[model samples]
Target: FALIHSRWTRRVTLLKRALSEIGIDPRRVHLEWISANEGAKFQRTVSWYVNEIKRLGPSPVAEVVDGQA
Candidate 1:
């Protein structure tokens, strides 16, 4: 999740759209609003992201970087 301010919401949407246009899966990029004091929320969000990434296995970008593709 890209933790960002509510005011920057529009920018985040635009960024996701641009990334999608480049062939990247937008679902792999998440936009989440998290406040500075929201430690629990941050932990939960990171944990969820870790599990999701693990389920997806190795990233194609990393594979290409390591010449494993």
Candidate 2:
């Protein structure tokens, strides 16, 4: 997902610990950097995550653990 693509890379060293506090799966999120001028690259990035989520159906990371809020 595009949820953390921006900040994850900037703070990857601390992402997992941060995610643990919020019940999110870092693996299910993707962080990529595409140059602003690289429209094609951006499109491909979007498509990739879209297909990934499609295959994953819905994310269970947040709701499967004893009714996460």
Q: lDDT of all predictions, in order shown?
A: 0.76, 0.72
Tens-digit per-residue lDDT, 28-57, candidate 1 = 677676789999999999999888878777
In Å, residue 67's CA in model 1 sits off its true spot by 2.0
Candidate 2 pairs with clashing backbones: 5-31
TM-score of 1: 0.65
Give per-residue CA lDDT, model 2, range 1-69, as digits (tens): 366764566687477567766765555667677888999999999999888878866666546655873
Model 1 ranges off by over 4 Å? 1-11, 14-23
Instruction: Indicate the residue-level lDDT of 67 in model 1.
Output: 91
**Top-scoring candidate (lDDT):** 1
